[model samples]
Target: MPIWGWPMTEILFFFEVVLAGLLAGTMYSLVALGFVLIYKASATFNFAQGAMVFFAVLSFVGFMELGLPFVLAFLVTILLMIAVGYATERLVIEPLTGQSEDTMLMATIGLAFVLQGLAQAVWGVEVRRLDLGIPDFPIPWLADNLGIFVSALDVTAGVVAGVLIIVLSLLFRFTKMGLGLRAVADDPGAAASIGIPLKNIMLLVWSTAGIVALVTGMMWGARAGVQFALVDLALKALPVLIIGGFSSIPGAIVGGLIIGVVEKTLEVYVGPYFGGGIEGWAPYVLAILFLLWRPEGLFGEKIIRRV
Candidate 1:
C-alpha cells in the first residue's frame, strides 16, 4: 500500500498531511480575509489586496535593512500600511464615490499596479529574506514520537493566524466600530442615516484590510522570501473568495482550510498517480464543485430578489 513510493497511506502520514494542509489553509484564509473585510464594508472588490501584501513585506524588509529592530520595523510598517489605506480611501475611493462597482474595482486594479511599482522602485525588485524570529526547524519530539513532519514555522504561522481570527472575532462582536461595519454591510444608507459614519467605517475597514495584508506578507515572506512572487500567492485568495463567498469571514476560514486540505491531499496522495502538479488546479475544482452545491458558499447567505 505504498503511494508515490512512500508509505503515505499510514495513519500517521495521513495525520501529517492533514496538519500541513491546515497550516497552509490558515495562510490562505489570512489573505482571503482582506477581500472579505473590504467587500463586506464597501461592496467593492479590492483587487489591490495582493499588491498590498507585497508592498507591506517590501516596506517591512526595507525598514529592517535600515538597522531597525524587528519590533520597531513591524510597528512602523503597520503605521505606514495604515497611512496607505487612508491615502487609498481619500485618493481613490473618495473621488470615485457614487461610481459603479465596476469603476471602483477598476480603480483598485490601477492601485495594484501603482503599489507594485512603488515597491519595485523603493525596494529595487530584489527578493529579500524576512525573518520574523520564528525558527525554521521542526519540533523533534513531535517528529520522533508522532512520525509527523511539521515545521516550526508552520506552527508559528498557525498560532498567529488563530490569534488573529480570535481577536477579529472579538472586535466584531464587542466593538462599536464593528457594529458600524456590520450596519454598513447591511445597508450603507441605513447605516449613514443612523449616524454610523459611512466614510469613517469604510476607512476603518480598509485600514483593517491593510493590517491583514501586512500580517500575510510577514508570514508568507518569512516562509517564501519577500518578492513579487508573493503577489501570486495572493491570487489564491480569489478562489477562496469564490468558494467561501465574497463577504463571509467564517466562510473564508472554512474555505481556506478546505482548499488547503483538498489541494495538499491531492498533491500528496493522488498527484503521483496522475503525474503530479495538482496543487494549483485542485482548489479551483473543489471550489467549482462547492458552488454547484451551494452557490452562496458554506457560510454565505443566499439573496432572494423580489420579482
Candidate 2:
C-alpha cells in the first residue's frame, strides 16, 4: 500500500529491470562501435564484423586451452587480431579500392565466411566457457538495502564501456591522428592530396575495429559462452547502429541505452500479454520506427545531394 498505488517491491523491481537493460545495452554499443569506426573511416559496412567477433573469442579460448596464462593469452589475442586486421586491409580491402560499395561489402562478406571456417577448423565447433573471474552474482548491499538486484559483472561492463567511450572520444577529438581521420572520413581524395596517407589511415581504422571486436567478443563470450552463435550477436547491433547513427560513437552509446531500457521494460511490463519473448523483437521494432521517421538518426549528419 504505497502512496503511488503500486507496491514498493514492484517499483524497485521496475528500476532493477531498467538497470539491467542499460548494462546489457552497453555491450551492444561495444559491438556497434566496430562498425562505426570502419564506416566512419572508409564508408565500408564491414559485413564480416560478427564473424570477426566469433573468431577473436574462439581463438582466445583456444589459446587458453593450450595452457597459456590468462594475461599472456589476452596479449597474444590482441596481437593476433591486429595481424588479422592488417591482412584484411592489405588483402581484401586494398585490392578493391575505388570499387563500388557493393563490391567492397561483398569482399567483407566473403572474408567473414573465411574467418568462420578457419576458426572452426582450428578450434572445432564446440561451445566453450570463458571465465574472466568477474562474479555474476548480485551486489549484497544494494539487494539488502534497496531491495534492488544487480549483477557485479553487469556493473563492471557498464564501467568498462563508459571508459572506452571516453577514451575514444578524446582520441577522435584532440589528437593529430584524429584530425587526419576526420579529414579522411570527410573526403579521402582531399585527405590524400593533403598528405594524410589514406591507406595508412584505413589500416589504422581496421586495426582499431579488430581490437574492438576482441573486447566485445570477450565480454559476450564470458556472459553467454563462446560459441558460433556468438556471431549472431552482431545482428543485435544493427538496431543500435540504426538508432544511434552509424558514424557516431556517442550516438551508439545513447542508442544502446534506449534499446536496452525499452527491451527490458517491455519484456517485463507488457510481455505477459503476448506470452513473453517481447524483448527479442522489441528493439528492432523501435529501430524500424526510427528508420521511418529519422533515417539520419539523432546525431547523424544530414546528407545533402547537389544536382
Candidate 3:
C-alpha cells in the first residue's frame, strides 16, 4: 500500500487534486489568451480585458434571459463584441494612436470602469447563472477506474480551450490576414509601408481580442456564475501571462496550467499550514519568482541589447 514513501490513498488524492487544478488552469489560459492576442497585434496592455469578460458574459446571459436560445444568444453576443471592438478602435485607440503608452493605458483603465458600470446598469447588479448545458457532475467512469474525480463542466471547458488554441494556431499559420497581423505586430510602420492598412488591421485585432474575451467570459461565467466576481477572475490570467510569456499563445496554455495546478494544489495541501487562503497569492509569488529568473517568460523571446 506504500508508493514513493506515501500511502496509495495519499497518492491517489494528490493525482485527483492535480487533475482538478489542470482543468481550472484552462480557464486561466483562456483569459490570458485575450491579453496575448491584443498585446501581440498591438502594443496596448488592454487593461479593459477583464472588464470585457464581465461584460460579454453579462450580455450573453442577459440575452438568454430574454428567451433567446443559447446559440442565438451566443451569436448576438459575438456581434455586440464586434461592435464594441469597432467603437473602441474608432473612439479610443485611433484617437490616441500617437499618444504615449501611459496615455493608452489610462484610457483602457477608464474603459474598464466604463464597461463595468455600463454592464451593471444594463444587467443589474445581481448575479446570474450561465448554463452552457455542460453538466456540473463528475464523470463516473473516470472516478471509478482511476480514483480521480473531475467535473464534466471542467472537462468541457478544457476541450473547448484546446480546440480554440489549435484553431487560432492554424489561422495564424495559414491565413493571409493572419500573416498581416503578424506583420503589424512586428512593425506597424513596415507593415504600413507594404500597403497593409494599419487601421483595418488594428480593428481586426481588437475584434479578434473581443472574441477571445467572449470565450473567456463564457468559461469563467459557467464556473463562477455571471457576476462581478468574474471580472476579478481575469486577474488570474496576468500571472499566467507572466509565467508563460506575453506574446506567446503556447506560453499562455502552459503557464495557465502551471498556475492553476500550483495554486489549487497549494490551497488544498499547504493552505492549512499557512492558515488557509494561499490560493490567492501563490500564483503571484510563483510568477514573481519566475520573472526574477527570466523576465520574458518561458516561451517569450530573449531580450538582447548591446551597450
The best candidate in terms of lDDT? 3
Colliding pairs, model 2? none
Whole-model lDDT for model 1 versus the true structure?
Answer: 0.87
- Stretches of candidate 2 exceeding 4 Å from the true structure: 1-3
Candidate 3 overall Cα lDDT vs. reference?
0.89
* Model 1 per-residue lDDT tens digits across residues 1-307: 6766667558667887888899899899999989988988888899999999999989999999999998999899999988999999999998997788899899999999999999999889978988777887778988788678888988888888888888887888799999888888888878889888888888888888989999999999999999999888888888888888888888888888888888898899899998999897888788788778888887877855676
Query: Per-residue lDDT tens digits of candidate 2, residues 147-214?
Result: 88888888888888888889888998999988899998888888999899887888788888888888
Worst 10 residues of 2 by lDDT: 298-307
- Model 2 residue 143 CA deviation in Å: 1.3
- Report, for every candidate in turn, its global Cα lDDT versus the true structure: 0.87, 0.88, 0.89
TM-score of each: 0.93, 0.96, 0.96
Candidates sorted by TM-score, best first: 3, 2, 1
Residue 230, model 2: lDDT of 82
lDDT minimum window of 10 residues, candidate 3 = 298-307
Clashes of each: 0, 0, 0
